[model samples]
Target: MSAIIQIKNVTKEFKVLNRREGLKGSLKDLFSRDYKIVRAVDNISMDIEQGEIVGYLGPNGAGKSTTIKMMTGVLEPTSGEILVGGNIPYQNRAKNAQEIGVVFGQRSQLWWALPLIESFKLLKDIYQISDSDYKSMMHLYQSLVDIEPLLHKPVRQMSLGQRTLSDILAAFLHNPKIVFLDEPTIGLDVSMKSKIRILINALNKEKNTTVILTTHDMGDVDALCRRIVIIDKGKMLYNNDIEHLKGFFGSYRTLKIRMDGDLKQQAEVIQKELPDFSVSADEEWISVLVDEEKSKVMEVLNQLQKSHEIRDMQLEEISTEDVIKKIYEEGVE
Candidate 1:
């Protein structure tokens, strides 16, 4: 119920060699003392409360991974302080390991040759989980998903989705106070993604475990997180609830339409014509994010209908994904 993780003015810096352009420069670079300091996390601070699921979001090359590494005690911060459950992560890594579990996407903690249940049992032993606690976790997993089929299957034989699901379940098997999940639903289909999201939601509710999730998937953010922290270029941008973030772009509406023509070409044309609004297209829909104060939804639809044959059109409110994308492009004011 209190702040379980407190990060204060933490900074992580890396020293990179300044390599030269030419062959002679390359040879001289080995002996060269030139180096550049890159700050991956720049004086960012946040508090994660007990039993809260916080979405840690950023674009690629943003400081998400570096922050995670510091939290997990894989790397020590260059400056400032961090306390995970009142213990410094880097200083007390062994003790910290006992209290937190982590699952990195596509990187299985489960043994490849072992049956899924075998891997779970192995984790139980490693974490020293008791029989009663282990049974409770198993019961919880069964309630949300049918695990009987996947239990005996070797982890190597399971699909990407199945492996990811198994890895998440294993992470929670120890009943750790905190869990770090990095892109748990990556490379999964819609059905699998929905199932995993449901499982994560249920687990957090039932167990009251604090989760720090680093993901690019907006669906994950919408389904699992109430509070989100977004960062870019090693600097904190927004740390607030989803609604407050959306309120920044409150007047925007997503005009979704089904068209018969080339979606990519039509998207380019629409983007060129309406330089202010954002346009995106997929196989099924061309979603134009229109600022309602500047242009009406119907007006945008009418313009789209001019070149692209609109099979079906709907005016929907902007989604969390759209808002996040806008923030990524222009950043928060």
Candidate 2:
């Protein structure tokens, strides 16, 4: 089947004023000001298929949001073409919007003063949804989440998790073909985070809705995304399934050890000694990635014994988080 969304060499640029320093610079007689062009989304491209959940991974200012805005029609690309469901989003925003749903972090699409049910009804009217469609959406949502207790409560009165969950439900209420979730689980408690993940997975399976998720939480990615796209500094770094991405670092194991030494300082030393492997701290443990293909785990540890002492250790397969970190440190080869 053809892709539901297609992006070809898309790029979005912005012009920012280069303000001078000091009060004299700020004044500048209001006549001379320097501006520079910034490429927030560079020449990057990808295809999103229907009924698939993709994790849009990136650091701050990595252009994930910019790409999403272009997909949703909030902004148009400065170059290249973006077609969402066979329609140009920026050119036909109204039609594009009807088929796509968006939920931004820290932003609620529901009415603050209205009850959850009232908000749902308002969305139904605004989307011109049929009565049958409305009923089905309610039925599906209620099945996924017990909304009876919170249905009558105003949105503002709901807790943070409740509000985030409600916003997600409302976004899917119209049964749009595509849903963009931006940090949907941000700031939610552990239990609430699990609930939101389950709700989303269930919705995708039941409705076959395509999901484009942007998140920093690795737990969310593990629970929700089978495939992920990694970008940094407005450039596409990696695009593939989690397994394929991990395969890039095959024969690598994470060696976690607990020691009495200062973990932060020791981790830096180990990283320097084993420049090929990535090292980090996890609470009481100093974690290091041991590339068995390059050097046996014991051989690597034997060298580390030169200065640091290991009290206890455990080894595990390279994880998604580890792969991401390694990629950031060293680009995909």
Candidate 3:
């Protein structure tokens, strides 16, 4: 599979006005424009293959949004090159628009006063979709989302979840080759989030639609993305498969064991035996934090079984959220 999207050394810079304090200073700044350069996306490069869903993540003020805008031709890059489906996005926006679909979680592209079905019809006309294709898409979308009840309702009168679902349906109505979903599940309830994810997965698998998802939700990344590209402070921090990213910080594991006898005594014994490991206890379980490189879980369990009776045990690995938090706080190692 060849790369469908290629971004090389892309950079986006903006000139932000310097606002002065107080009314007098603010009045003075109106005539004289004092500005500072802000590089929202700095020297980033990545390749996204067709039919792959890549998670684009970062902390607030990161360049995730800037990069997306550039890719969608909303904003032109200051430097470097971007090729989407062999065409420059900024240079060929109209052509690219026909190939790509976009959904902004906080913003709606639908007609505000019109019925949801009317908005979809408007999109179908704009995209020049055929009657057969429209029916096929509606059939597939209806299976994923129960959109019939809300189709006749005005978009402004619908709930957030309903509107979001309608927005997603509109984005894919054209059956574009690539999709950009920015916080598609934001502000949605758990069940709604799950439903959206399932629909996204189905689209990707069934149609081979390439997706670039920008989201703060780890659940979205975990469920839909096998590959992730992480950026912070306008720089690319990590770009790899999900498992490989986990392996970068997979040296530690947590063990929660259920013991038959006194939990505190068991914790104390384990702590004394493995002084290097961190051990704690509650009413029923003894928790041991183990560095797999320094000491193995089997080794600790072997020692514990000799002194105490173990009923059950669970070994856990580090979570994606924890790894991402560490990267944001400490920078990538």
Candidate 4:
């Protein structure tokens, strides 16, 4: 199947003006601005198919939002090509808006004083959604989110989760083929986050909606996205299956050992014995990083067991968050 979205050599740059310090400099800046081009996105490209939930991840100011804005037609790229649903996003704004839905976590689309259902109805009119289509969408959304009870309450009266759920419904009221969700689960409690994730999953299962989600939550990436596109410093770091990313960054393993006896002396001994490994010690447990080739799990266990009584032990691989951090700190190839 052809990709629903194709981004080729997409680059976006913004002119940043230098601020003046003194009164004279401030006045000068207004008249003659000292500006430099800041590359928000640098020749990044990817393909996203229908029915795929992709996690677009990066640290703060890594151009994650910039990329999303370009995709949703909110911003134009400085150079390169972008096609969403066979239409140029920035060029054909109206047509692209009809096929796409966007939810920004920091902003609320629903009116504060209006009831949730009232807001949804307004969206229905704006989108020109058929009555039948509106009813069907409401049925599916209500079944997944169970938000019917909160529909009558004003947005200001609802909790964070309730407002977020309402916002999601408003975005999708038009039954857009593609959706862009920016930190949808931010600042929500665990239970509420789970609810939103479940609703997204159900939507994908039933409607095959193509979703591009940007979040810092590793759990969200693991649960929702089969593919991940990681960016850092306005550049693409990795774009591949989640498994491939895990394998690429999952080189080091951690060994956590619980000690039956006093850990102070034993921890010192282990550290002294394994000079090449990175070690940390607490009251009851000793942790060390082991390179798979240089050191094996069995050797570490066997060596540690000779002196101290090993109460329990476990091996932990690098997590998704760790991999992402590594990429940002030391640029991934």
Candidate 5:
């Protein structure tokens, strides 16, 4: 498949005012405001194919939002080029808007005092959707969200989850070829989040709509995205499939054992046997860290069972959260 979204060496910079400290210094600086250039996105480049769902993630001040804004044509890049569906988003915003949809978790595009159905009607008019297309789209969206009961309620009177669901429906009403979802499930309950995920997956599969999701919620990344792009300090850190990202840190595993006898004694014995590994124990449980390249978990367990009765054991792979956290702490290698 051809690349639907191409970002080439994109950089976005901002000139922020520098303020002086204390009353005397502040008074002197009021006449002349100094400024410094801060690059929120620096020399970043990637290509997203059509019909692909990608998770765009980063820590706060890591420029995730800045990148999205540039892609959506809300902000122009300081340098480099961004092409969505073969059009320059910042230059051909009106034409690009017809082919894309956007949803911001903290912002609403619906009328505040209007009924949900009325809001939908207004959007249909704004988009100039045909009667048959509007009805068909509503039918499909309602199947995912069950928006029947909430249609009569005013948007301002709905709950956070309800409002978000409504907003998502509104975004897709036009059936845009691409969509950008920014923290769509933020501040929602578990059930609401699940519903949102289901809706997103259904839309992607049914329409082949390309999606760019920006969120801190790992659950969203795990459920919907096979590929993820992470950035920090305005630089791209990692861009690959979820499994490949996990395999980057797959050399280590955690082994937890329940002992029939004294856990501390067993811990000491294991520690002696594997001097290079880190071993610790509590009342009834012992935990050991093993580097898979150097030692096998089964070998360690068999050696322990010879001296002490092993009640139970569990070997766990490191979680995606821990792996991403390590990247943030140590920077990408």
Candidate 6:
């Protein structure tokens, strides 16, 4: 399949004005202000194929929004090229807009006081959707989203789950070839999140719609995306299959030791026994991070047995959150 979206060496820079401290300083700067350039999207490039859901992930201030803005043609890149559906994104924005749909979690494209059905009607017109095609989509959405009950209620009267579901349906009403969803499941219950995921899967399967998802929730990436692109500080860190990311940071293990006696004594004994491992403490809990490939976890347990009585012991794999944190912390040094 041909790539639907192509970004090559894209970089977005912003000139921010410097603010002065004192009242006189602020007054003086009003006439002539100093500006500093900040690169938000730094020389990033990626190719997204048709009908693929790609997870664009990172920590806060990691340029997830800036990249998405450029992809959606909401902002222009300072340098590089982007082609969405064979058209330059910023240069041919109107044509690009007609080919893509976007939904940002914190912002609503729907009218606050209007009923959801009314909002859907307005979108149908805005997108110039044919009457027959609109009815067909509404039928599918009614079954897929279960929006029947809430369609008559005002958006303000709807629950967070209801609003989110409606917002997703609104984005898909036009049946665009591609969609960009930023934090689509934010602030929703588990069941609602599942529903949204199911709906997204259905859209992909039935219509072959390509989706670009930006989210903090690992579960969303795990459930929906086959490939993930991780970024940090406006740079691409990792871009490959989810399994590749897990395997790269999969060398570390989390060991939780439960003590029958005082926590202090147990921690001291473990530290003395395994000096190579990184150790930390909580009130009564003791956590040890050990390199699985280098250190033997069972050897540590055996040593702890001679010193302190063990009530319970558990070993867990480091989560995606921990993996990214470790990468960032190590990069700092």
Compose the digit string of candidate 2's lDDT tens values, residues 197-218.
Answer: 9999999999999999999898
Write the residue-wise lDDT of candidate 4 on 1-333 in tens digits: 779999999999999998778999888998875798999999999999998999999999999999999998889999999999999999999999999999987678889999988988888888889999999998988677777688899999988888888888788789898999999999999998888898888887888999899998988897899999999878899999988886675467889998766677777788998897877878767888787777787898788788667888888987777777778788875
Window of ten residues with lowest summed lDDT in model 5: 245-254
Q: Which lDDT tens digits does candidate 5 get at residues 162-230?
A: 888888888888888889999999999999999999999999998899999999898999999999999
- Could you tell me how far off, in angstroms, the CA of residue 54 lies in candidate 3 after the best superposition? 0.7
Cα lDDT tens digits, model 6, 1-333, are: 668999999999999888777998889789766888998888899999999999998888989999988888889999999989998888888999998989887677789999999998888888899999999988888777667798899999888878887888888889999999999999989998999899988988777999999998887887899898888889888889877766675477878888766777667767877888877766667888878777677877787778777788888888776776676666422
- Please list the residue runs of candidate 2 whose C-alpha ends up more than 4 Å from where it truly belongs after superposition: 258-286, 298-311
Query: Total clashes, candidate 4?
Result: 0
Q: What would you estimate as the lDDT of candidate 2? A: 0.90
Cα error of candidate 5 at position 309, Å: 7.9
Q: What is the C-alpha RMSD of each candidate to the true structure, in Å?
A: 3.5, 2.7, 3.6, 2.3, 3.0, 2.2
Candidate 3 lDDT over residue span 239-299, tens digit each: 9999888767657788889977788887897799888887999987788878888878899
Error of 2 at 67 (Å): 0.6
lDDT of each: 0.90, 0.90, 0.90, 0.87, 0.89, 0.85
Candidate 6 residue-wise lDDT at 323: 70
* Runs in model 1 lying further than 4 Å from the true structure: 255-288, 294-313
lDDT of 5: 0.89
Query: Tens digit of lDDT per residue, candidate 1, span 235-290?
Result: 99999887888778658888888877788888888889889887899998888888
lDDT of 1: 0.90
Among residues 3 or more apart in sequence or in different chains, the pairs in candidate 3 whose N, CA or C atoms overlap within 3 Å are none
